[model samples]
Target: MLAMIEDRALHTDLALERPVPALQAISHDPSLRTTVALRDGRRLTGVQAQWAYLEQAAAWVDDRFGADADADTVEVLQRWESVLTRLERDPMECAREARLGRQAALLNGFRDREGLPWDAPRLGLIDLQYSDVRPEKGLYHRLLARDRIERVVTDAQAADAVEQPPEDTRAYFRGRCLAKYGQDVAAASWDSVIFDLPGRDSLQRVPMLEPLRGGRDSVGDLIDASDTAADLMAALAAR
Candidate 1:
């Protein structure tokens, strides 16, 4: 079922990567539109794209689980549906509800995985995940969230990321590999790409995990000021 959904997403107008920017662009320019196909064979556009996907997911949950789903899963799905319904009415409340619901779902997953008692006080996990909601904890929370629900990257940055590598981390090295090797990069496994540096005697292997630590390694000012691969490499090397 997961594979089927993923296949559909690949073929449909589902902007899975950097979706916030895509939605924003669609809102501003009709020419930059995207559509999502509904279960009824109807294609919804603009702001409806995300909602349609959520509705489809909800439908899948209902169809698969029906009345036999565990209590925790059913409760989480109910909350998700409620949040979706509130999208047209109270978006702020909807966001808050969704967060709480996600926290609940995460707790349930953790409990099941660890074989912990269901009644255990796992709300502390939310704080551990999101930290305190203070300004000082903003970066921590953003780093933890990453591509989940966080908007760590700006819309412009997200848009550019689709085509070019982020010029603020080790991803720049991967981009350099792509530029130098072109189609040869694909010959390397999907997990890591090997690059032969101009001056280095040995081939360098760039891992796909490079960008994951960028938030911790990159200085805000340096990332903002970086305009070249050299700048990013210098910043990363400094760290």
Candidate 2:
């Protein structure tokens, strides 16, 4: 779930954004148990319970947004209804559809809140666990545990990252904000931060959603030359 949230934060480019949807599918002995955690933090257990929650959310959207609701919002509710209709006929299909439909609804809800377009790329599903491994013998376990310490990012790099946006991504722009305005100003802004440049009709807002595009060598020169966040942004923009 944490990975999912991070992915959403880094990749969602549409004007709309929302918290990661909460849906857990646990494999039981003979069936799968589905759980839905609502935005209010209420957990709905069982297929029936989840369906009921969707129904309420759909109704609430209609009541709250009324004529202002977008087509995606309406479609999400309709999709839920269709999934519910299939519950008795095909339980498996119903479960699959319910998950997809609920995800769409959750994302669209963000669009409703911000009055933004729904054109961002949909999130791809990621498997969080591996299932084929069996317990090893004591000797095998000891051998495996020998090399348990793994270091992906060095401590120095992580410390630099706190103040400098990654040069390979849009985060470089965000780093500029932090550099110019200080941490408090940058931390308070989200999605995009507006800047009052000279030529624009209105303030320019820089989005921080683009993923890292640099390789090991891509940001080397910029990192070496940069003494401040502003310098880093300028070097990255020049690149």
Candidate 3:
């Protein structure tokens, strides 16, 4: 397993070294070939892009463990070293990304705190309007009751809360309303994104990227674990 993780890390390193200017080229990048995008319209800086590459690689490495394996599994704990190698390839990348992130954050904070650049894109959000496509409101109501969601949401602001929410419980019952009516719904759902370009009153819809988030390291971990498991299995089978 460790060896497998090492191999994937090597590949990621190779990808980083053999840089293609276009972020789109990542789709063709050898190993996982998975896609990532910042919460839809979000763009990543040089460092964020680099970290995201390793993070996903780490996630794939970790995911290789058997279902029963706990986080404490010897294999899981040891995987950190593999992750270290991948991220440490160029420590400056981390620092660089951190600096960029902080700068952006500071700028945003100033915008909010001091109210500078009212003309700047003012923390736009995709205001998803719920459509009735839930199974039943019971389960959804139960889930949405959590503080994280309830804090921002008010009463069922969408269609008549169906007795049974749409087949897709999470989507059909987002903050007590479905943004879209459909049988298949995923909790990892975002309604038609409303992008408020700077200087626009009404939010406009724009193309959202796949993978609502970027830079999750689960994929890298899983890949490493799978490689380890496969090697062990292969060796055992050969014997």
Q: Pick the candidate with the highest TM-score.
A: 1
Q: Which ten residues in a row have the lowest lDDT in candidate 1?
A: 210-219
Per-residue lDDT over 81-183 for candidate 2, one digit per residue giving the tens place of the 0 to 100 score: 7756665355445422343333344445556776656554332211111111343533222323564223335769879878766565546545555565453
Greater-TM-score candidate between 2 and 3? 2
Please, what are the lDDT tens digits per residue for candidate 3 over residues 1-239?
35556555443332333334445554433232334444444444444465655565456546764455555554444543443443345332222222222234434565778676645553231001112235353323333444212222235634344443333222222322222311122223354323233444554442224333211231222223433323322332453
Extract clashing residue pairs from model 2: none
Better of 1 and 3 by TM-score: 1
- Candidate 2 scores a C-alpha RMSD against the true structure in Å of 18.9
The list of candidate 2 runs beyond 4 A from truth reads 1-26, 29-45, 94-239
lDDT of model 2 at position 209: 46
Candidate 1, 56-151: lDDT as tens digits: 665666766788877866765676566556644544443334453344456656788888775566645544756566645643455345544533
Evaluation by TM-score, superior candidate among 1 and 2: 1
Q: Candidate 1: global Cα-lDDT?
A: 0.53
- Give the whole-model CA lDDT for all candidates, comma-separated: 0.53, 0.48, 0.37
Task: Provide the TM-score for each candidate, comma-separated.
Answer: 0.30, 0.29, 0.19
